[model samples]
Target: MTEPAFLVLTALVDEPRHGYGVVREVEELSGGRVRLKIGTLYGVLDRLVADGLVELDREEIARGRLRRYYRLTEDGASALEAEAARLAANARSATERLAARSGRAKALGGLA
Candidate 1:
């Protein structure tokens, strides 16, 4: 999955969210790294909806505009979990390798 899709799914993992809510949540989750414009967000939403990864939960008229709320489907949740595990494992491997490299460097420093 793309980073945007993963972040979007994560934003809605805990609860349903409107477009603006999802945008804010994604920004927060990404530490402001991912700033999603409405058009981009809707694009991802449309794809996810078509893929059965997300569904519209409800809609409301707020401020004279229709506000749609969306939630993740079971498949979406499972996919997010799998992606998280994969990222975690990759991070662990990289960290271990870095630590080993740093240890060797430190040991070789005395010889140098």
Candidate 2:
């Protein structure tokens, strides 16, 4: 999954959210690293809906505009879990290699 898709699924894990809500949650989840534009948010939402990973939970109108809320599907949760595990494994591999490199550097009088 792409980072935006992963984050969007993760954002919907707890509760259904409207477009703006998803955008805010994604930004917070990514520690401000992923600020999603309105158009991009809808694009991801549309793709997820088409993929059966997310569904339209409801629609409401507030302030004279329609607000569509989205929720994660079972498949989405599973996919997110798998993606998270893959990312964790990749991180661990990098950490281990970096530690080994640091050890070598130390042994070589900090040449690295």
Top candidate on lDDT is 1
Alpha carbon deviation, residue 106, candidate 2 (Å): 1.3
Candidate 2 per-residue C-alpha lDDT over 1-112 given as tens digits, one digit per residue, 9 for 90 to 100: 8899999999999999999999999999999999999899889888999999999999999999998899999988998999999999999999999999988889899554
Question: Runs in model 2 with CA error above 4 Å?
Answer: 110-112
Instruction: List the candidates' TM-scores in order.
Output: 0.96, 0.92
**Model 1 shows how many backbone clashes?**
0
Scored by lDDT, model 2 comes in at 0.94
Q: RMSD of each candidate? A: 0.8, 2.0
**Tens-place lDDT digits, model 1, residues 1-112:** 9999999999999999999999999999999999999999999999999999999999999999999999999999998899999999999999999999999999999789
